[model samples]
Target: MHRATFMELCDLLSPALKRKDTKMRGALTVEKQVAIALWKLAMPDSYRSVGNQFGVCKSTVGAAVLQVANAIIDQLLSRVVTFGNVQTIVDGFTALAFPNCDGMIHGTHIPILAPEHRGDQYVNHKGYFSMVLQALVDLKGHFTDISVGWPGKMHDTHIFRNSGLFEQLQEGTYFPDQKITVGDVEIPTVILRDPAYPLMPWLMKPYACTLDSSKEQFSYRLSKCRMVVECAFGRLKARWRNLLS
Candidate 1:
């Protein structure tokens, strides 16, 4: 991460990560805790190896990493990753040739070590233990919303339906009183997804086995727009090799 970005994150997380010194010994400063966590995330190393570099015990490293991670999530998630007003989202997708689209939704598998119990629940069709990270990304390749911790064995559609985003859409409060015009027809803002997802008023999927020219054209345009989510996931996994490993 860039120095400025890291500092900004630290500032945001300070409230949550700040520690009170005890009489026995001062706790590790927030800076050191964040550094330890960042190092662990940036490298694929065991806790013991990371602890050796930081001159701390393996358990301390683990605790610090988890603490810093939760702090980041609590402080930065809503601020950095959000879907703004409906008009802005519509304009973003319109620029990509996908009229009436609010965002693109997809899911990727994040591999993980098998757990002690119910390990089979994490084993996906790809024959590996993993977790699913379902996300909605805007045209700029930024995540607008994300759902994590679902077992890989679950279908992408199942994960999406169970997500908070799905609840928001069902409640009809995510983009209230907003409509988009596509040629002659007016429709509500919708998210674009693949065949794995279900078609709904707020979510759209390409027509399967399209033979009509218009349908094919629509599918082509939707695919081009939906590819943004895949690219976002690709860039994320590439930048964080720990996710891939």
Candidate 2:
């Protein structure tokens, strides 16, 4: 982003925090650090290269990278940020374009370096090890309600149970007074998933499975509507390769 945009974000966030006194540093500019972070994100540069050109420590460069990235995320990205009826929460979200479709929930495997991690956290679903990052992204693929980061070895179902999304819903909090749930199985609330799994409430499914063309027409339509979330997810992954990697 341009310096003006960064400055704008800083301006927006500045109102939320108490002011601090600091010289920033010597001849090296804070803007330069910000620029470095941007460049790293735009084009995944090594921390050493970023630090070398930006005239800062590698650690500082990494910190700057995360700070600037998160700031950009916080500033530029938002929920129901895409096109659609944001009031309706769908099961899977591809992007903001179809908010009426709700959102999509999927597990993302992120490679990490936590040597001491063990048990389910340490288990690897695939041959390579990674961390599971599940997110409830809106139509625009931006996480709206929940995002859980855990080790890759964990079961998707177990992760879901532990994610606190269910627990959060059980508490009847409010993103407002209403919440919509969509999944492959049944659940125990006003909102629920499809496919009708056992021991769950609000199970939304096709009701009857048929290959004769007219079976589960509503389900087919819902799936068609939900494809927007899939597209949104594709765009999101493409935009943030580092996130999925």
Candidate 3:
């Protein structure tokens, strides 16, 4: 269960969440409850089922989910999710993928129930398709940014633009340079659906890799850096499958 890792996480949270008030110090630790809740969410058992297993009320379980999810995402990702010395923009997907290569993006569906959803927005796409949207993630698969919920029927590019990802890019909040495509796409780069869309300069094509003479010679070149994202996605999906019921 990674006791050391869990304690380290709790220790990091302590400064902000732990209080001096002796009176506030209770019989149990909030961090423990939060960790349990996180496990439940990642695996999403029934609320009543979790309540029984955790020996706590459903309300407490829900609170724990929120508290722990936010804490881990903020703290762990802030420290653990950063890129190491790699050219931040050029090597980073978000820094590379916007307004370029038709802003190539990938979508994945998380398994969740309809009853757990807030509305169609969570599962909302025309035809009530699975919750899916274009996403830009680093080679490490940390979500650098994502487009909001769009109907599955919607074109991936349309979803990219509508999700305000494009607007944010225009404002330089995402990609500073507007000419790089962070990913490979199913279509040709020269084609353009919108007249306003500008063709990008750097187009990446990892999937359609060439068996060129040089590639085989440079087998150990450690090139095709984008494979990191694919590897990351494989691990994430594997974990998700293990956890989700």
Candidate number achieving the greatest TM-score relative to the actual structure? 1
lDDT of 2 by residue, 1-245 (tens): 46687776556544332234568844434465566766776664678987888777898888777666665557555532432344544434323222223444556665555456464465586655676766555544455554546777776667766766657644655233543344653223232233422223322334455556655555565465545445655676676775436
The positional error of residue 65 in candidate 3, measured at the CA in angstroms, is: 0.7
Query: What is the C-alpha lDDT profile of model 1 across 175-236, one tens digit per residue?
Result: 77678677898888889999888899889889998469999988888999988899999998
What's the TM-score of every candidate structure? 0.89, 0.60, 0.59
lDDT tens digits by residue: candidate 3, 1-245: 47886777788765544434367645337565657666686764876788888787778778777676676666666575442332443334334332222223455554445644445545544345455645555544565555544544455555655666567554555443434333564332211122222433223333225568755433322223444445555677798777654
lDDT of 1: 0.88
Best by lDDT: 1
Candidate 3 residue pairs in backbone clash: 120-124, 125-151
The residue-level lDDT of candidate 1 at 36 comes to: 95
Residue 91 lDDT, candidate 1, scale 0-100: 86
For model 3 the local lDDT of residue 95 reads 40
By lDDT, the candidates rank as 1, 2, 3
At residue 88, give the lDDT of candidate 2. Answer: 48
